[model samples]
Target: MHMDEYELEREASAPIDMLETYYRALGWEYERSGEDEIVSTFQGSWTQYELRSIWRAEDQVLQFLALPDIRVATEKRDAIYETIGLINEQLWLGHFELWSASGLVLFRHAALLEGEDGATLSLQQAETLVEAAIEECERFYPVFQFVLWADKTPQEAIAAALIETQGEA
Candidate 1:
């Protein structure tokens, strides 16, 4: 998909359409609910992720969220929050957050549409944004799991997630 194909016709519409095309090219399952919102699914090695791309015309920003299949119980929120903080510090592109209301751990990022001439959005940028979200989420998924189920401390979970290993070497 090219920028011209995904160029915002009105600052509000068309971006989502471009996103739809992009996801389609990748053979990912997706549903476009509206001109500004899209829901997609990605099956990763660790888990299935629910991906969302929302375009806010008023703010001229695009929000991307990749949610792995994990939930934080009420008793686990404190530890999960701490782990998220540590994980976020290690991140350069997007950040992980706990959606308190839903108790869902999700990776979120926002891209600012830098111009007024109907925002030139390229597929490459979109892919980078989406990839960052999913990669970060997959990278630290075990951190959340260790804290919630294995009862590991935040520091320990972060350390486990960061350990370098040559598996099967």
Candidate 2:
């Protein structure tokens, strides 16, 4: 699970022209959707995640998203909303948001930059932001599964998902 070597190499290569450089250096499959948006995919232990980064130059914010592509049934959304709230409370950075219109759940975080800093972030910061987003999504993938497929309550799902086993089975 340690990608430190890859991140370190990218972080030391040069200043980041865009956040996607960090992902690209890691050999992530990605493309530019626009001048401000980059979309990529990452394979996790539990799922394939669609990752995106958008640079809001006017606002000086770089926003990242990681989607596991789970679609919540309308009937399950209320529970999912509760599940999202519970999961977000445990997160120190970024948050899980249920896109009500699309019934999609994804992780979102943003790096706010000073106007003088422009749209570019240091490679280290870029690595931290992108990796943290992906890690958060990976960490919580099962919590949503427990809610959607197992009928577990938000509390129960969070409790189950957060439990750490001592040794490999």
For residue 106, model 2's alpha carbon misses the true position, in angstroms, by: 0.5
**Residue 58, model 2, lDDT:** 71
**Compared with the true structure, what per-residue lDDT tens digits does model 1 show for residues 31-123?**
888788999999886899999989998888889989998888899998888888888888999888889899999999898886656864667
- Give per-model TM-scores: 0.87, 0.85
Q: What residue pairs are clashing in model 1? A: none
User: Residue 104 lDDT in model 1?
Assistant: 94
Lowest-sum lDDT 10-residue window in model 2: 9-18
lDDT of 2 by residue, 1-169 (tens): 3446556555332222546667766787888876778888889888999988787877777788889888999999999999898888888999999998999999999888664434446677877887898788877888899999999998988778878311213
Q: What lDDT is reached at residue 14 by model 2?
A: 21
